[model samples]
Structure formats: C-alpha cells, structure tokens
Target: MMDIVKNKTETSNSVWHVEHATLAEWQAVMAWAKDEGWDMGLGDANAFFEVDDQGFFIGYLGKEPVAAMSIVNYSSSFSFLGHYLVSPTYRGQGYGLKLCQSAFAHGGDRCMGLDGMPAQVDNYAKWGFAGGRNNLRMVGQVQQDYHCPDYIELVQAADIDDIVAYDKSCTGIDRSALLKHWFIGETRYGFICRTGQEVTGIVGVRQSQDGYRVGPLFANTPDLVEPLFVAALSAVPQGRQVTLDVPEKADPTLIKLAEKHGFESIFHTLRMYRGEPPKEQEHKVWCIASLELG
Candidate 1:
C-alpha cells in the first residue's frame, strides 16, 4: 500500500520533498487524478517517463507523494515542462509554488511550452509564461462511415526513424525520443500516411476513459489532416467515442471537418510559455498527446 501522508520534524514551513516517480506510485497518483476528473491514463505513465529522461520529480509531504512534474530537455530548440500536479489535499499550501520552481530549475534556461489550464493562466503568467495559442480539447461520437484513405497503414518499428525525422522538422521542439516511447513503448497504434514510397503524415491513437483519443497528429498540410483523422479514428473500437485536440489557428477546414464528423469542443486552453515562444506554427497541431506531456 502507498503511504497517504508523511510529516517530517526537520522543517516548519511545510517543505515538500520532491523526488522522481516510481512505477508503483501509479496507483496513488492515478487514484488522486481520477478523483479530480483528469481522465488520465496511468498505464501509460510509466513508459511516458522512461529511464532516459533528465527530469521527473515527485513532491512528498513527509513520505507521501503530493505533487509531481517533469522537464524534458531539448537542447537549444527548447525544453518542454509538464506532468505538474499537486494532490487535492495539499493544494494551496505553497506546494504548487515549490513544484513549479523546481520544474523551472530543472528546465534551466531553455524555453518551455505548456498548455496552461484556463484557471491557471494568470498564475502561470506570474511565473513569466505568456499566452500563445489555444489548445482545444474536442470530442465526438465516431461516425460509422468514416472513410480512411487507402495509403495509410500500420506503422512498424523500422518506421520510427522516419516518423522522428518528420516530427523533428515539423515541430519546433525535437521530441524524437519521446515519440519513440509514446508510439512504441505505450502500445498505441501508429498510423502513417504515405505518398508513394514517401511518408507524408503520422498519427497516434491511445485509449483513455472517454474512449480512444488521437493525439500528436502530425501531417504536412491541412488537406492531409482529414485522411489522417480518418485513419486514427478507424482504429477505435466500434460504438466508442473518439476525441481529437485542435490548435486554435488550424485551417478553417478542420473545424468544418470536426463538425461534419460530429465532434465538438469540450474545452480550450492557452499554450503559454515563459520568455519567448517557439517559432513553429501551432496552426498545424491537430492533437495534444496529453496535458501531462504536452
């Protein structure tokens, strides 16, 4: 059983000790997340924070994990900061401030991208993060006749290199390593769009509480997104719901596509950054892999 709380005699300021998360802590963290309605996928959390990472911290009040966060290093391109969470019981007790400061210290001088929740924008802005693009969480019931283009196919291990290469150039942040772990290690479906022998687009679909979700959906053009969406949705179990996140500035066609397919916006967020935001186009992002990792 996980320890629910711990108090130390060394500090009077309620100093929360933050450490790396263990595989077994999934139960404790996830239970708290479910209780808070996060729709998290704890099963995938292990692989998501693989051994190769430079930062993944869990805050403890005594012996209990009360807050957690990770900073993924990306060299000069920019590091991504995410997985920041404070347990419900310990929130508003200065634990979140410690967690955020620790996360920034871990990230160092690199720029960070985070989809700040609506309520937390002002709080994050106080930390030097400026609002960037909108990250909309959209959902819809699967349409029975959703037709996939013939060229898309199931991805193999060998295709990872190609996917990484495409992802590196398509997005400002180099997330090649995370892509490998997310696509292969998490047991999610990897669908690739091809034009002749050339790989043109890629998408990943994973299971969540609401049903299947398509995330990190990357393609060269807005036109390619329709086909990619079809391929991603095709992998979902019949009768289950399908959801996709959309970047606010994406092609107007995408909104029509979502509506035509019966999808609706569930919530939206501002992708904020401290210092300068990256130069890549948020308009092309069709899905956010997760709030924790994005």
Candidate 2:
C-alpha cells in the first residue's frame, strides 16, 4: 500500500500533489481503466510495475486520488506515454496537464509515443504528439472448431530466450521483464510457430476484464500468423470473446484473418509520437501488446 506522505514541494495553496504510484495505487489505476470500459489483462499491473516502478504516477488532492498516467522508458532513446486519466470531478482544473508534464520531465530527451483516444488526438497534438497510424481494436467470439496447425506448439520456459529475441526484433524495444511475467502465468496461454528449431512467430492470450485478449502477435510473414492466431483463440473457453488491436496499415491479409474469425472493429485509437517513431518491423506485428503499456 502507498503511504500518503506530503512532499516537501507541496504548498498550502496547491490543489493537488503529483507523485509516483505504489503497487497498490497502480492497482487502483487499473481498476479505473476497467471502469472506463477498457479491457485490460488481469495481471497487467504486476508486469507493468516490474518494467519500470517509477513509470506510474497518480495525483492526489490531499488524501483523495484524482489523476493518473504512465511514462514507461523503454530505453534512453525511446519511451511510451499511456494510462492517462483525470477524474471527472477534477476536470478543467489542469490536473491532467500537471500529470502529463511530470511524465515529460521523467522522460527527458526520449522520443515518446502514445495511443490516444480519437476524441483527444487534437489535445495530444498540442503537447507535440504528431498523429501516425490508427490502431483498431477488434472483438469476436473464439472459433473453437478451427483446426490448430500441427507445427504450432505451446510455449515453455525454455523458449523464453528465443521469444524475447523475436519480440525485440518486432518492436525494437527490450521488454524482457514484462514478457517474463506475461508469458508465465496460470491465467495466460502462449504459443509459438517454428520452422524446425527456429522460432518464426509467437502469440499470447490472457484472461481480460470481459473475456480474453490476444496480443504481441508477431510473425515473420502473414502465412505464419493465422496458425498462431487460431492456436491462441483455441486456448480460450468456448463462446468467450477475444479482442486484439492491429495497426491499420498492417498487411491486408491480417485484417482478413480477423474477419474470417468473426471479429468486428469495435473502437480505435490514434498512434501518435512526439519524435521519430521507433524503427519497428510493423509488418511482422499482427497485434499490439496493449494500448496502456505501449
């Protein structure tokens, strides 16, 4: 639990104090995301905290929490801003901007990126985030009857090194800590595609607030993606909906795979960056890890 200690910089006239969130406070932030209709993975907070404990932030009006945001520094050259929210009661008081500023200060000199809600794109633009690709969130029921490819196999602890390497190649970000927690958990399932001893693709599905979510789906080519996708959905319980976010400019066949599996576009966010976007292998990324973490 977080101790509610007053900072030395706090002044009597200040309406709110911004500080890094403790583990318990981070859980509160994830709960807020769920309440806002965001389908978050059950173990996201734990994995996220391990990535960068100082990344999460919360604002408080004395003892009451009012705002939250995250600025995860992937490396000296890159960072991602996300989990931004301001309590309804505190709107128009500049609390969100204060929190945003804190994040910016914490990520000095690094290129920052965010998945901004469509309605807030203009507001983010004012803060230097230039719009890039659109990320579409698609949802659909798992097709239990689909045949699983014989080449696809369940991920094991031994496969961690290869998986991490493949992920780094796809995203251009080192997230080994996050992947460790995300891949080895009771509520999650991970699958890999191989061409005889070499990993060619990988995907993971985890229990979410509403159902299941498949993400970080990466493959060397479109042909290797479908099998991994089908294998992931097959691990989920029958009749449960599975959601995934895909970059709009991804290979057209990737979208067709979603449609073939009965998925529909439910919502979207603008992928914006404050500096040069990371030189990622976008064509290999069939699905993103999560909007909150990215």
Candidate 3:
C-alpha cells in the first residue's frame, strides 16, 4: 500500500509539488483511479493525453503519486475539471482540496465547469461551484432485430468538422478536439444524423464494464436523435447492454424512448458552477460523453 501520512519527523518545505503526466505515468494513474472506484477505460486514458489541450497531473507527498486530476481547456468557450482523485491512504488530508484549487488555477479564465457530487456540493461551494442543472445517467439495450435509421450515417473522418458544429448547438461549450479524440481516435462506434447538406445530430458508443454506453449523444430533436440511438445500438454485439447520459430537460419523447428500451438511472449529478451559471443549451442534449470527462 501507499504510505501517505505526512511525516512528522521531516520538516521540509510544504512541497506538495504537482507535475504534468507523461504517457508512461498513465497506467499507474489508471490503476490508482480504478482502485478508488472511478470507472475509467484504457482508451479513455489514451485519448485524454493525446488531445494536447487537456492537462493531467499527479501530486507527490515526496516521491510518490498520492493524488491526481486533469484539466480540459475545452476550447476558447469553456474548460472542464475532472478525473479528480486522492489515493485511499491520502484521504482526509488537505490533498484533495489543494488538487482542486490547482486544477481551477490551471484552467484559468476559460469558464470552467464540473459535475459535483450532491453530497460534495458544499465542498465545491467553498471553491466557487454552485448548483445549476441536473443530468441522469441512463442505460438500455439495442433491439435484437434492430432496423437501421435512414438518416443516421456512419461517420467518416472527413465528417468531424460538421459533427463538431452540431455538438456546439447542444453543449454551449465547443470541445471539438476532445470530441474528435473520443469518437474517432478512441475505441468507440460513432454515428451521425444529417439534414440535407448539414449534420444535425451525433452519438458515440463504446464498450464499458456493464455493457456499451452511448455517451456524448447530441442531437437537435427527438426525431433526429431516435435514429442516431438506433444506429449506435445496432453497432453493438447482439443482446449487448447499453447506457446513455440523458439530461432531465430533454424532449419527453426522448425520455420515454429510453424508458421503453429499459434505460434507467444508474446515478445522478447536479451540474454545478461557482461563478455565474453558464447558459443552458436550447437544443437537445440527450446524453453526455462521460462523467469523468465532463
């Protein structure tokens, strides 16, 4: 186990140093993350590092990594703080609070946001986060005899720009590079719905411990979103389970459809903020990519 208590014998400077994570450090971080009950995939680790804009860090009590966090300078629009963790042995110390302050400092002026756990809202409030909207983490399965949705198309690398534009309408912030890394570069199945010459909706499915997840599922309406969901589930193995993160305020039709297919809440989060609340999207945001990334 990790020896994390502060050494009473040593009186060195309060050097809770932090460093940018290297690819070699990923496995250690991933292992530590999962051990702390954080659900993460190997591919997710790779994509976060490759995006270049996301900053990953490990904190040291001396020479070992006892804490970790990441910052996604999503775009000029907004930034996100996630993957925040403290080694089991290190809990109750000031490490978590320090790491969080560091993340926001690193993210700087880019309208930072994070999905704070309900019980921890007070903790985040001390750091400037306030409750805003809520999102439900839902799951379901693909029909055994699935029919392809006519408007849904298999996305080509060339279609990334169009997809990014469509994503912005649903998520007030534009994380284009992060989305590209997630849907195209990572081990995931992605589909999009187009209206004439323009792409209007998109959904991505990736393998998960429970089954498959349609994360970052963004669309313009119930009509456009339904087809994308069908396409995502059809790509998964037969009878495979699936999940999606649907916002509570999305179209009632979308909510019923997920319920019709057996999707229910695995968890819920109060999407909070510290500063002035950001504008909520007017378009349909049926699912979020992942709690870790948001």
Candidate 4:
C-alpha cells in the first residue's frame, strides 16, 4: 500500500491511497463498469473476487475512490488485466496511469493480457502490449425454439469437476474457482455435450442487465458448437437479447452461427498481451467467458 499527498495546498493536500479493494469497494468498481456501458453479468464480482482476493486495486483520493484495476494472476506465468477505469472527474490527472502501474507491479514478470477498447489499443501497445485477435461482441434475441442436440445434457453440481477439467483443457488455466461460482446462480444456465462419459462441449449463459450473455463455449469439434450454443440460447427467456464475444481468428464457424441466429456485431475489443501470449486451444474457445476475466 502507498499513500501520498500531492501538494501543501488545501485541495491538493488530500492523500491519494492505492491498495487492494475490499468487497464493498469491488462492488463499487462493478457499478463503475455498469455506468461505462459494460453489461456485466449478475454475480460476476463474487466469482472474480474469488479468483484472487488481493488482485483488485482501487485508488482513492482522500476517502473517494478515483480509479480501479484488476490484475488476475491466474498462474505464475500468466495474468489478465481489466476493469481499468478512472472517474471522469479524475481523468487527465495521471490516476489511470497510477492504477496501471500498480497492476503491472502486481503482475510482475508474467505475461499480461487485456481486452482493450479500440480507442485505447495504441495506448496499451505503448505499454508493451502487442495486439492479437479482435473479438466481436455479437448480440441477438434468443431463439426459444432452437434445438439442442440429443447428446447435450444440463450441467449439474455433480458435473462441476468434469466441466472445470474441460475448461482447463481449452484455456490452459485453472479457473476452477471462477467456474464454481459462475455456474450456480439462480438465473444461470449451463449444459454439456458428452459421448460415452467424455465431455465434448460445454456452454454457460447468465442473465445480464440487458438480457443474457453466453460464454466459455468450448467444443471439441465444430459439429458440437452450434448445438451447445443453441442449448444455451434456449435457456434465455423469449424476446430477451443475448450477447457473445467471439475471437475473430478462432473458429470461423462461430461467425456463421452468430449470423444464422441473427446476431449482429455491436462492439469489438482488441486482445493485447505483454510478452508472449498464453498457449491455449483457441479454436476450442468458441466464445470467451468474459473480456475482463480472459
């Protein structure tokens, strides 16, 4: 933790504090994200917090939080940076850069990754983050009658271990803690496609502010992808919109699936990483869990 006063003047004398955010403070960060037009899923904070209790940092000018960032060290050699924000009134005063410094320090020598808004891609690159794929945020109304394949089954608590193992195979990260919280919420829905007890595909969808979001859509083959997607989409209520973030360079079939379902690309983010990107089965990542988490 570090605290400093900028000047002797009354207004500038207020101390600027930088440290890990408490649970309540983390909720405040989520509120900031919502205000920024990010449609975060309900119960996201709890799962995110569990990943690394000390990973979220907030910068306070006196008693008011002015900036926030998260550097989730998923493993010794890899981490993700996200939820980076500075209050509108506090921008241009270097608070954002200070928060970034804290995130980088916490990340240490690990390869850091972030899904940066298009406008900030260059800024991230200037900080040694190289651009990778552009992720498209596709949105559409859920198709109530979409058909789920016969092999697909609803994911239950008993299947968590298998789901987590499947996720690790796709992402190469042990995000079991996140998966645990992510799959059990009242408004959440998850399903898996299996063959003779072997999980071949999985997808999870959760209610969001606007509608719902599908993610962590991992599949062993393209043939299984659409069914898993349809199963997740069918879980959403009729007439509600759904969103999915798909990596442009991953499975091309993902784009076709989105189009067939009448999904439109409403937003995009640049995937950037400092040092080499983590090795994962990118093709298996039909839809990312979340830009913030990934």
Best candidate per lDDT, number?
4
lDDT-sorted candidate list, best first: 4, 2, 1, 3
Superposed Cα deviation of residue 21, candidate 1 (Å): 1.8
Q: Tell how far residue 289 is off in model 3, in angstroms.
A: 1.4
Q: For residues 1-294, what per-residue lDDT tens digits would candidate 3 score against the true structure?
A: 222224322316445766677767756778876675445543776666655533777777667777888777666546677777788887888788766655566667667678756666788777777665677767666657666687677788888888777776667666676667567644577888777897778888887655677777777767776777778778788777776666677356667878887777777776776555456574567778877666
Q: Against the hidden true structure, what lDDT does model 1 obtain?
A: 0.70
Candidate 2 residue-wise lDDT, 130-236, digit = tens? 96688889999975665567889888899888898889888888878789867668788789898888789999999999999898899998888888888887788
- What TM-score would every model get versus the actual structure? 0.86, 0.92, 0.85, 0.92
| Candidate 4 to truth, TM | 0.92
Candidate 4, residue 49: the lDDT equals 83
lDDT of every model, 2 decimals? 0.70, 0.83, 0.69, 0.84
Instruction: Give candidates' CA RMSD values in order.
Output: 3.7, 2.5, 4.2, 2.5
Q: Model 4 segments beyond 4 Å from truth?
A: 1-13
Q: How many backbone clashes can be found in candidate 2? A: 0
Candidate 1 has which clashing residue pairs, if any? 6-62, 19-58
Off by over 4 Å in 1: 1-15, 41-43, 51-54, 143-147, 185-187
